[model samples]
Target: MGAEENIGGVAAILRPVAAVIVSVSPSGCVELRLPSRRRSWRCDGVGSAMWIALRQHDGRIGEASEMLAGIWRLDPVDVRCVMNSWAAELCDAGFLRLEK
Candidate 1:
């Protein structure tokens, strides 16, 4: 199955896994660590921004996309697509979980 299918599409709610450790640098770099899985992921630039926005918006993809779209002056639909894709990646990597 595809990432989108696994995540139940763009409207899916996502939250960081409770056991995962997250850290952000002043330079907008993000690090996610799942000690149980012995896995870690690092994000910078747009990825970092998206992660921050996702957390700020309480895992609401639409709200995060809107915030990014406005700041980047990009189409909302395009921003949403990017956000959804990124979210799916994070979910598959086990740093995030689907809430609904």
Candidate 2:
């Protein structure tokens, strides 16, 4: 299965690799870096919130999506889709790993 197929699900557990460096700005902007790959990604606003939520929720995708959905007044399913897509993209980029 593709990365998306493997990761874009609410049950998936997502975690950044050991070498990942995460920086959060006072404005809620999040920066993720993988020194080994010389790769970085910036997440602002809602994306930042999602990242924080995932971390706070211990990588539980369902919890993260539900938290975001409540904050944004959106459907939990829609938030899950977005979260899963984002996580899958990060996984494909080698920034994150999926745990069974």
Candidate 3:
């Protein structure tokens, strides 16, 4: 109903659809062998939002969160929850920095 919900809905649909093009399979998997998706990759809530948000940002969590919040009119607190969780996961995975 709101812009945030619209953005989230669009994101929810687009990412999974686009993930077909978004995902990389460099493991020598065959054209037919690649999975539609893995069970573990499905996520929800702020964590899922964060994951999609960060991936869409070219890996820039800060700008992604700000843009995501602005475009969606979501509360900063909610946006922060998405971003912080994403940053934490990325950091744990050795993919992102604490400050940036």
Candidate 4:
């Protein structure tokens, strides 16, 4: 089974739109929602990553780069910075892992 399958098709919904797989934690997932609605999703993942990260995801491919930068990592923040330029289009989809 794939990561999504392993996670119960929850993150699967984000595969198409997500740039990188952010950390998944017990609280919830940090993915971008890509539905035709303005309301997106957000992730409450673990680590200091989330503390400084925004707990939301969006489907707008334009903002992927920015989202990646704010991912609580010290990597190149250029792409992430540019991605934030479109924060309006981004959606921070939050999902709870299905209880086994």
Candidate 5:
């Protein structure tokens, strides 16, 4: 695996796991629920966009980011950074797992 796949790379496929549940509001906000931990997280605008894109694309991070960049009219570099950070956080939280 390349660095991207090894470390929360944009190329890495990320999915909601570990009993985590994702919900989207009618207004387009995204929320995450960790039932085991009894905790919840509300994603900001950028995160909402990423989450939706990831879900639509079968957890393909790089492809999701690219699609989000075009849809949101944001810089690709910024989107990648957010994706990397978000993926790392999810991995650490046990909400996301990488496919071997």
Candidate 6:
């Protein structure tokens, strides 16, 4: 399936790869590094919340977004959009995977 199809809906399962290291700063910023690739991504604001929620929930996409939405008092629609966009990027970078 295409990458977007892979994460087509709320039912899609997402799991973080062991190779990527996700760090959350006290200020609620997020940083992710792929040690093997020697590359990193930094996320602030909403992105950081999404990152931390993913980590805390073992990369379950739907649950992570729900938790983050309630925590941040945001619309679920917005949360899902952020999750989908971030998931696409992380998947493209090989830091995350979609399980059928």
RMSD of each: 3.1, 3.4, 12.7, 13.7, 3.3, 3.4
Q: What tens-digit string does per-residue lDDT give for candidate 4 at 48-81?
A: 2332233344332223435555553534455444
Q: List the residue pairs that clash in candidate 2.
A: none
Instruction: Output the lDDT of residue 34, model 2.
Output: 90
Model 2 per-residue lDDT at 100: 59
Minimal lDDT window, size 10, model 1: 1-10
Off by over 4 Å in 4: 1-27, 30-75, 82-86, 91-100
Off by over 4 Å in 2: 1-11
Q: What's the distance in Å from true for residue 20, model 5?
A: 1.4
lDDT score of model 2?
0.81
Q: Tens digits of per-residue lDDT for model 5 on 17-61?
A: 859888887887998888888878788887787778888989877
Best by TM-score: 1
What TM-score against the true fold does each predicted structure earn?
0.85, 0.84, 0.41, 0.21, 0.78, 0.74
Q: Which candidate tops lDDT? A: 1
Q: Candidate 5 — which residues are off by over 4 angstroms?
A: 1-3, 7-12
- Cα TM-score of candidate 6: 0.74
Model 6 sits at a Cα RMSD from the real structure of: 3.4
Give one digit per residue, the lDDT tens place, for model 6 in 1-100. 2323344463456777778887877887888889899988888787777777887887676678888889879997688777888888888888788776
- Ranking of all predicted structures according to TM-score, beginning with the best and ending with the worst: 1, 2, 5, 6, 3, 4
Candidate 1 TM-score versus the reference: 0.85
lDDT of 3 at 80: 60
Note the Cα lDDT for every prediction shown: 0.84, 0.81, 0.47, 0.36, 0.77, 0.76
Error of 3 at 69 (Å): 0.9
RMSD of 4: 13.7
Tens digits of per-residue lDDT, candidate 3, 1-100, equal 1223233344222122222222323642211111444422323444545656666766555556787788789876677665666455444433333321
Question: Which runs in model 6 stand beyond 4 Å of their true positions?
Answer: 1-11
Please identify which of the two predictions, 3 or 5, would achieve the higher lDDT against the true structure: 5
For model 2, residues 69-99, the per-residue Cα lDDT tens digits are 9989999988889888888777788877878
